[model samples]
Target: MRVVSLVPSLTEAVALTRPEVLVGATDWCTHPAGLDVARVGGSKYPDLARVLALRPDLVLLNEEENRRADADALLAAGVPVRVTFPRTVPEALTELADLAGALGATAEPDWLVAARRAWAALPEPGALRRAVVPVWRRPWVVLGSRTFAGDVLRRLGVANLYAEDAERYPRPDLAELRARRPELVVLPDEPYRFTADDGPESFPGVPCALVSGRHLTWYGPSLAEAPALLAAQLAQPG
Candidate 1:
């Protein structure tokens, strides 16, 4: 079954599990390093004609990473499209299982098994640290209420300061974020790559943790390593 994947993480998940099924993927799908598939385009603005030209049996999309119009167009053109919206660790695991099943592939990949175990083995929740996690820098958009990243941090004993905000991803006033007085400021490298030299300086008094965006954001094989990787980064003194 030929597949076209718009979500980078999902592309990696499918490619790692069944490489032959993936005939096309977004340019952002950079995992499995020498992936020799047709590059459709970016996740948000894929080349519809290029994807249709691939004549894939299935097209994978993420609710957050892709646009609805693209999915609609694919469906209208009679290309089967599967859209996944995993908001938490369990949901992500379930999504992978469903995706694998759809592709006639086994969901019991070693990395997937390890990821489930890693998340399950997370230490019992302890004292929570209030943190403001910024995904972008210019105009400063942060992880807000009901987001996958927020849930990931919550599992690690960090409470997102904007978890109850009206918007899932909100661009909050820097002064407002500072006023919240977060115990920690977590920074990720994707969407808008935040770095030690760039992000830390914004929060002068708060402890900042530089984290791998793939671990914090991507919901694939990386899940197995994220728990320990994030814990170590969060443990470091900012």
Candidate 2:
């Protein structure tokens, strides 16, 4: 079965299914090393004609990455598209199982059990303080409540100040953050890397920590590695 992955995690999923099943991937779909193939531009803004030309039997997408119109057009053209939104660890495992079933591969990884154990075993925090996490740098978007990233922070006993009013990632006015007065702010190295020292000056009076976006944001197998990293941060007294 020829498969095309437009989502980054699905690209990693395709890699887990073994290289032979993957026929095409978007430019951002690099994960499992050494499995280079075709690149289709940005996952959300893919060239529809070029994608159709690939003649893939199946294409993968994420609600966050792929636009609805594009998915609709592809479906209209009779190209099957599998959409996924992996929020919690269980959801992520489910998505992986669905992809494996789609690929007709039986071997699977049980990541949830390990994740729960690690989650439950989180070290007692030296201090529980509120923090704001910025995922993007330019407009200064943050990881608010009801999202995977927000939930993860909650698990760590860190309160999310914007949980009540903001969206998953909302660009609030500078006054809002100042009013909230978070104990320490966290900026991730992701779509835009915010170094610990570089942009903290923009939002003064709040001590900040530059964090690994993949660990804090990426909601799949990556979560297994997140706790260890977070533990180090929690160890530091506020």
The global C-alpha lDDT for each of the candidates, from Candidate 1 onward, is 0.90, 0.73
What C-alpha lDDT does candidate 1 achieve relative to the native structure?
Answer: 0.90
Which candidate number has the best TM-score? 1
Tens digits of per-residue lDDT for model 1, 56-127 = 999999898889999999999999999998889899999887777788875477778899999999987799
lDDT by residue (tens digit), candidate 2, 28-91: 7657677687777888788878788888899888888789998999999999999988666556
Clashes in each model (backbone N, CA, C under 3 Å)? 0, 0
Worst 10 residues of 2 by lDDT: 107-116
Q: TM-score for all predictions?
A: 0.98, 0.85
In terms of lDDT, model 2 sits at 0.73
How well does candidate 1 match the true structure, expressed as C-alpha RMSD? 0.9
User: Model 1 segments beyond 4 Å from truth?
Assistant: none
Model 1's TM-score against the true structure: 0.98
